[model samples]
Every structure is written in C-alpha cells, then in structure tokens.
Target: MIRTSLPLKKSLKPKRCRSCGANFNPISSMSKACSVPCAMALNDAAKAKSAARAAKDERKSLAERKAKLKTRREWIAEAQAAVNKVARLRDLLAGHGCISCGARPQQKFGGTFDAGHYRSVGSAPHMRYYLPAIRGQCVRCNRDLGGSAVNFRKGLVERIGINRVEEIESMQWTAKWSVEYLERLKKVMNKKARRLEKRIEAKSEVNQLEAVE
Candidate 1:
C-alpha cells in the first residue's frame, strides 16, 4: 500500500446566524451562536416550549385513559350481571337433578360440576341466557364426554338410547333459584328487578291514561 498526504487550505471561514444576523468568529470556524448566553437563551426557550407541549399531551393522555377505564368498568358490571342472572336460573333447576341422567343429590357427587348445555347457546341464540337449557354435569362425566353437544349426545344415546335423549330435550323448568356463578347475585337481581318494575309501571300508567281518555 502507498502512503499519501493531502495539502491543507488556509481560506476556511465561518457562517453568520440567520436569525440574529450576527457573524460567528471563534478559534473553531463552525461555531453558530455568537456567545454562550445567546446559545443558552435559545435552547432554554425551546426547552420551555417543548415542556409545555409535553405537559399538555400528558394531561390529554391521562383523560383518555380515565375515560377508557370507566367504560371498561361499566362493561364488566354488565357482564357480571348477565352471569348472575344465568346462575339464578341454574339454582332453580339444580334440585331436579342432572337433566341428562336424572342423577340425585347432585352436590353429593365427589367431583366438581359445570353448568352444561343441552342445545348449545351458539346454536340457540334466543335461549342462550335461558335457565332450563343449562344442566349440571359431574366433572368426570363432563370431561369423559368432552363437554360438547355431539359428545354428550353420543354418550346419552349409548347409555339410555335415543328415546330418553328426546324426552330430556323437551322437559320444562318449574322452579327458580340462585348460585355463585358471578359476583353479588342478589344486588344484580335487585337492580334488574327494579328496572323491570319501572318499565311495567310506565306501561301501566300509559294504559291507565288511554283508558281514562
């Protein structure tokens, strides 16, 4: 490899500031601001404006977060209410035994049980929240049967034949009860009942006015 040397020029110079119209003169030619105070003042003013903008943005972000949290809380309450309503319906049906096998004293079963569906909520959207469609299943049996309509139905057909399966699918609910499916079932039930009562009262008032006229 060959070594090379480049010649130095003596005519290099610094440029003037466009804002203050001041020329920069220093040992280093590339200096922009005339003095330390000038540079500091410009930087300080920029920093202050940036801090103000950041504070404003922070307040806006906090407000948006609070609103989002409030909406989430409201949705959670509504979901809890729906779950409680379903539980109340379940309790009423619990005394009758397992809708599938006619098992007695269901709570005496050694294993845990889930509220199983005869006709799946996905298929019967209208009766999705209905209590009679729900049934208690022993964990062992539920797990063994795969916790699905197809699986449960197959098991039922094998155990008691198609005739019994058809009979179970048509049984009606004759009682109402509540269970621990969600938080504060009593409070949710009271609130819903109150709302329903108010609606009934409003309808009755309208009917009374029409009758009077």
Candidate 2:
C-alpha cells in the first residue's frame, strides 16, 4: 500500500532565447527565453502581433456587415405590413367584410382576415403599396381561392368609383421607393392603425353597454 512516486520527466532540449537565439538550461519547463530582457522583448513582440491580428479581424467583420446590409426591399416590406394593418382595420370598421365573399366578420367561423389587393402584387408590382387597391377579405377567399378576382373587381369598382378604378388599372408608371420614405410611411400607417383600433374598441364598448341595458 505504501509506494514512493517517481520524479516528473523534464524536456531534453535546453531553453533557447526567442529574442537573441542564445541557449541555456531552463529553470522551469515553460521557460522559453534565457534572460529577463529576452523574455520581455519576446512578450512585447507577441503582444504587437496579436494586436495587429485583432485589428485585421475587426476590419473584416465591419466590412462584411456593411456588405450584407438591408436595402430598400426590407424597408418596403415593413411599410407594406403597417399599411395592410391599417387597411384591414378600416374595412372592418366600415362593415365591408370580405370584399370578395360579402361574408361579415361575425358570420365567419374564424376571426382571421387579410388586407387583400384588387390588383395582385405579382401582376402590378407598382401598386403593391397603393392603399385604395387593398381591402379586407376572409382568409378563405384571399389565400385559398387566390382572391376571387371576379368578385374583387366588382367590389373594388363599387367601393371606389369606376373612374378611379380605371385610373389605377391604366397606371403604367413604376414608383421607386426610398428607404427614408418607406420608414416615414411605416410610422404614419402604424399611428393611423392604432387610432382606428382605439375607435373600434370604444364603439364595441358602447354596443355592449346598450345590449346589457
């Protein structure tokens, strides 16, 4: 049970000064430089090399981030979302439920709805952000049947005048959106949507109180 431990093995190679190339027996296994001055010089050089490498990596990372930055497309998408939200709420409040099906929100099985476009975005990319072109519709009519184009056209004409519908249909100009414009539009649309939501909530409260009375 009582056993004596053997001494730890030491490296056979003598320590060499990394800074001056002088060889000597090392005090410890980790001792690389022979003299204090050699060790200090080696440390300073290593620190400088590490700093240079770190600076290079930081520059590379910043350049890559700039290269992969979001463009006008992302801004447009966000602005469109806010616009659609406001349009859907507007239609709901106006009692123009499901422009394609004439199905009221209360009549629908689910509460889900969408701001459907009269002119499909794929067909008219220029009118994607056009507020008048978008109207509220049931999920079934919009997503499942691809907007029911026939009914949508009729409803659109009735909702907005025939002249306006013709104008939008004849529009050939493509508008190039800027990020600044899109950002501003997004804020405006969001504020309008929030105000509409408050009105809808207040109206509901009034109707509920009347029903109870």
Candidate 3:
C-alpha cells in the first residue's frame, strides 16, 4: 500500500504598503511596506531629527563654557586684591618687635618672624587681618607660645617676669596729635572693628532666625 501527505491549507490575507497605500503579496504576512524606497525615506527622516537635536545640545554646551570662564576671571581678580592687601599690612608691621616675645629686631639673630595677631580670624575679624594688630615673632617663640594671645602673654610673663611686662605695658608716648596720623590709624582700625561687630550681630540674628524656623 502507498501513503501520501496532505497539502497545507492557506489563510485568506492581503499585504499593504504602510507609506503609499499600495497592496502587494509579501513573502511573509508581517511585512508592511511594499518597496525599499519607503523604508529608506522613513529612516532618513529619523536621522535628520537626531542631527538637529545634537546641534542644539552642542550650542548649549558652548554657552555654559563661556559662563564658567566669566566666573573664573571674576574670582581671580578678587583673589589678587586680597593678596595685595595682605602684603601692605605685612610691610607696615615690620618695624615692631615680636608681638609675643618683645624681642627687638636686632636680637632676632637673623631668624625670620611672623606677624601675629592677638585675635584669630575666625573669632575676631577686627584683629584677624589688621596691620597694627600684627607683631613680629621669632619662629621658636611663635611655636612655644602656640600662636594664641593668652598663651603668648603667659610665656612672655614667664620669660621676662611680671614686673618687666607691666613696665612695658605702661610706657607712655607723647606725640604731636596730627590729623593725618589720627586719620591713618582710624582707617586701619575702624573698618576692621565695624566689620567684626557687624559679623557678630549678624550671627546672633541668624541664630534667632534659625530658632524661629
């Protein structure tokens, strides 16, 4: 006996072009477009849109770069001014002996000195960066005193005796009180004092505000 296989049945269906509304018999049922040109045109449109978006992003990046450069230049100028101000103050305090040790310039023995302030910058803005408040100190003395007014004073008393320190503090000066000298001294001291006072007041105000918040 001979046996034969039955033929597969076909489903009723028609293929259509998505872009041109044309109909054709596609090898597969899932195919949408009738010709390759329709697919290429769709791809080209998508590529053009992507290129436009990239160009827009590049322009935004360049604008951001320019803004950053402008900000950097402004900061550099402010830094230079601060450095110059410090230099001027340093020169003005050179003639004074070590603020801590009272060691005369001649007694320094070629040792370098630092201009120290009685008040630190964080706690006392008035004295922190002022020239008159600065004092020359030998490296060893500065280290021994631990760079604090209280510590330095204690060390000074130990080194020179309390009587001598009292005498040094009591020395009187008689000078022709000139307007120019008074103005110069006030210029140096007053601004710093005012700023320090303002900062303290502001800090207190902020604390109150924070408490309310």
Candidate 4:
C-alpha cells in the first residue's frame, strides 16, 4: 500500500546548541544538540538543572505546609486570649469589685485583678468561654484563697442572678472547638474587646476631669 499524505514542514528557526551558544539547524525538529558530545553534555546539564529546581520547590512547599499547620494552633490560642480579654472588660465595666473578695482594685492590698472562673475550666470546659461564669477577682483571692469559694458564690449570685448561676452549675456537656470556629470566635471577641477598651478609656477621662474640678 502507498501513503498519499503530504509531507510535514520542519521548523525554520535556527536552534542554539544546548551545550554551547553556537547556532545550528536541527537535523529534525526533535534534535537538541548539533553534535554527539554536545548532546551528552546538554542532557547531563539539563538533568542537573531540573533536579536542583525540584529540590528548591520541595523545600518551599514544605515550609508553606508547616505554616498552614501552625495557623490552626495560633487561632486557638488567639480565641482563648480574646475570650479572657472580653470577660475581664465586662467585669471592669460593671463597676464590680473582686468576686472572691469585696475589695476594689484601689482598695485591695496587691491591687491586681484577674477574670476568675466560677466553675473552673478544668471541670467545665464547656463553660470555659461562658461570660456569666467568669467575674473579676483580686489575684490573692483567686489564687491564694482558692478562688475564695465562700465569696465567689455570693458575688456570682449578685452579678448574674441566682437562676443563671444555677444554670451554669447544671451545665454538663463538653464544648468542641474547631479551627474554623475558633478563627470566627477570635474575630468576634477582638471586636468586643476594642469597643470595651474605648468605653473604658472614655470613662477614665471623665473621671479625671471630674476629679480636677
């Protein structure tokens, strides 16, 4: 049988020698080097260059993967920080003294305050971020006196009401936090923190002005 198809045209452009800069016409379009030695050299050099690029790319990809993993852990930590910040702000804004002690910051001996948890995060992880479960307390009362159990109950009842306090005590479910949920919670808590900071600042200025008068 005879093939009757027209012949294919070759590339007209002169190709540069892969091993040297000399220009030459390729015997066929697929030909890379002008001579045998140049072809072997070119092949080796091409292989080495390709290997180097692959290694560099692998290193870059590895670093990026590690960074992505780190983000989830960082978001979780940020969420916790934001929650604590908001809780502390809430206590301060309410003009309440320490939940474990009746002493105000100025009136207290050490004058340090912390957002103390009523149920404790270890026992009630579900209520870890519950606003009503936390209240302001002097450092001594919170840490030294073991959350000052006696006064803590009294303060919790007064601040959040008896019913709400009872509800928190009755809570028994575990709260599951995902990376995505924590990221969203961080944003919300951060916004609340900013607003609370502004309010606190404004109130401080007003108090200063009044004292001066």
Please report the candidate that would top TM-score against the real structure: 2
Candidate that beats the other on TM-score, 1 or 3, i.e. the better one: 1
Top lDDT: which candidate number? Answer: 2
* TM-score against truth, every candidate: 0.30, 0.63, 0.27, 0.62
| Model 2 bad stretches (over 4 Å) | 1-69, 106-111
Task: Residues 30-141, candidate 1: write the lDDT tens digits.
Answer: 5656778777777787899999999999999997676455543354445444553444334433333444454443344443555565665445433444544455555554
**Poorest 10 consecutive residues by lDDT, candidate 4:** 102-111
Q: What does candidate 3 score on TM? A: 0.27
Ranking by TM-score: 2, 4, 1, 3
Kindly give the number of clashing pairs for every candidate: 1, 0, 1, 0
Query: 128, model 1: CA deviation in Å?
Result: 2.5
- Candidate 4's residue-wise lDDT over 1-213, tens digit each? 997998898666889987787899888878788899999998899899999999999999997687467666587667877887798788787787888777787634544887788988777778877777878788889888888877899888887799987887898886888877887798899999999999998998999999999
Write model 2 residue lDDT over 183-205, tens digit each, in one string: 78998999999999999899889
